[model samples]
Target: MEHSHKAILVVSFGTSYEDARKATIERIENDIIAAFPEYRIYRAWTSRMILSILKKRDQIIIPNVCEAMEQMIDDGITEVIVQPTHILDGIENHIMKDEVLSYKSCFQSISFGAPLLSGQKDAETIVHAIGKRFEYLDKNTALVLMGHGTAHQANAVYEELGQLFKDMGYPHIFLGTVESSPSVQELIQEISNYGISSRNCDSADNDLPVEKVVLAPFMIVAGDHAHNDMAGEHPESWTSRFQNAGYEAESVLKGLGAYQKIRELFVEHVQNAINNINE
Candidate 1:
């Protein structure tokens, strides 16, 4: 293989689900490879648990960010760009950036790209992508996007994206987090308040009641959270609640990384980070 001093490190909170890891994380890395073929691409995962599991179970050894940086230094690479697949600028993003920045003096030019949903425009793009995906739904159905929320202020991205759905002409859509506000309970209430509930034809316009609700992961990779928490048979799963509420509930079982537009945003962010070398 040819050697390159410049490298792109595609970072992600790795998943143990092989299929999901391929569908989401691998796809994103492939997108990066295609966009920047001139630069060699390396991967680093933020998930220590996943790393351990893969190493123990499959004999696969993937380095963490710190290790990856050390490897790059040993390889005599002086230019680096770290791109995270995290959905928000939350704790994960912060930790990754700090680790990458810790090696600032080792590389002549090192930059960290923005997360998947970094600002207003990113939220709008996500709304449009998801809106297009669920355009088939009518007023009798609601599309609930489930995000992996954090206590960090960046968790606001979930609610912000939810409102953007309305502003972008998809009022039937909603966003909820597994760990924060707009929680499952809040979504039930939001559904009820919006008159989209199938129970209690209390809405003045009974015909407008939602007959179905689709749950999809708004995170990059739909692994454990998507499988067990969002669609699992457990009684508290999102699917179970909607099913019990007299609505036909379905889990999309796919992640944001499955979308082309979403991948494009990450590519754009990487380019922006590469450009930072000049500044």
Candidate 2:
């Protein structure tokens, strides 16, 4: 399993947010290129809908694992390694893995990389990344992370993130899903239970209205969910939901991949996967 023959495939769930998604993918690709300069590099997007929706005449269309590997084979590439830029081993990563495994015969060897927040080390890195972006608010305010939860087992990772935030001694960190358990409504109820009013009220000391509460997504890119579901003006969105609940809600559009520390997790995962192949 020599590294020289292998072509590194960086795969992501893809995003409709053209500029935002491109920046995230480019950073990961640049990091891999920097580390494994000897290995040929290819980029892929796992979401077909996203790719189709964000397609541009000028930008290179992100290929899938099979398509990228086929291209590598055409270029005389023998060995191949795939690194999924997904945040977890969810549906997107599972699909990529299946596609890569189907082409095992095409290459001398094939290796798959781990998701961004795979293990404890990766989790710590994520926590560090988030910490860098937000400071722990006082007991009066809490940080809420909205993740695109799935029915898949990987969705439990959202709970892990919540626990991590709790262990970090942050003031009552809360987690919610866009599609799974611990739904946004549940999270809102829990937050309201804390007596943290979502409304702007005049400060007793300053005599001025003070807004409290910050909401951020636990996603890799602030794509559809972040833009529409979390921050959209729609009445059913999390932002509107929070507002209706009497809380001032603010949405942080930056996804997990936007953080340098989180990006480093991708690099570490790629390196570890490459090392495993060597072993």
Candidate 3:
């Protein structure tokens, strides 16, 4: 096989769910491969727990970012681009960037791609991309997105994302997180305050005013948090609460990475990073 002097390392938090990995992470990787046929591509995961789980349960072996970089340097690949699948400039992304930078001297050059939602325009772009995923919802149904929020100050990305949806005339679209601001209860209250709740019923045809609520993950990959926290049968899950509240709740069970537009944004970010390297 022909070798390239440079390579692209696709970094993700990784998932134990093979199907989700295919639908989201792999799809993004494939897009990157298609765009840069001359450059070899590699995969690295950030979540040691997920990597360990996959190794034990599925016998899947994937390297972490540092390991992948060491392998690349050993293979004579001198330059690298590290593209992450994180949804925001949150804790995970910051750590990933730091790790990649620590290996900068090991390579001739290294550039890191921005997270999925980076700047203000990216927030708007993602709102439109994710919004397109739920065009089927009617006025009587609320669309609630569950993001995997971070303890980092960058958790404000979710807040900004939610605000963009509302500012763009999608007030019925609510955003919540499993580990940060705008919890499910907070989003439910937002829905209720918007008069899209059973308590504000208007007619039997519409039933509970807000007859249904579509729940989807706002994260890059719909792995553990998406399944167990957002859609699981557990009483604490988002689906359970909405169901108990007399609303028809449905889970999309897909991540933002599953969307074409979202992937395009990542590709654009990679291109920007590559351009920066060229400059």
Best by lDDT: 1
lDDT of 1: 0.89
* lDDT for 164 (candidate 3): 86
Which residue pairs clash within candidate 3?
Answer: none
lDDT of 2 at 213: 59
How many times do residue backbones clash in model 1? 0
lDDT of 3 by residue, 1-279 (tens): 777998999999999888899999999999999998988999999999999998999888999988998899889999898899888777788888888888888888998899888898888888788777787778788898998888989888788778889899776788988888988888777776666454566666543356689999888888888889888999999999988877799998898888999999999999999999999
Model 2: pairs clashing at backbone N, Cα or C within 3 Å: 198-246, 198-247, 198-248, 199-246
lDDT tens readout by residue for model 1, 1-279:
778899999999999999899999999999999999888898999999999999999999999999999999999898998899998888998999999999999999888899988888888888899999889887788898888889999887788788888888887899999999889889887887777344556656444666789999988899999998899999999889878877789999898888999999999999999888876
Clash count of each predicted structure: 0, 4, 0
lDDT of the structure predicted as candidate 2: 0.77
CA deviation > 4 Å runs, candidate 2? 1-4, 56-60, 136-139, 196-211
| TM-score (C-alpha) between model 3 and the true structure | 0.93
Q: Is candidate 2 or candidate 3 better by lDDT?
A: 3
* Model 2: number of backbone collisions: 4
Worst 10 residues of 2 by lDDT: 202-211
Residue 68 of candidate 2: its Cα lDDT? 83
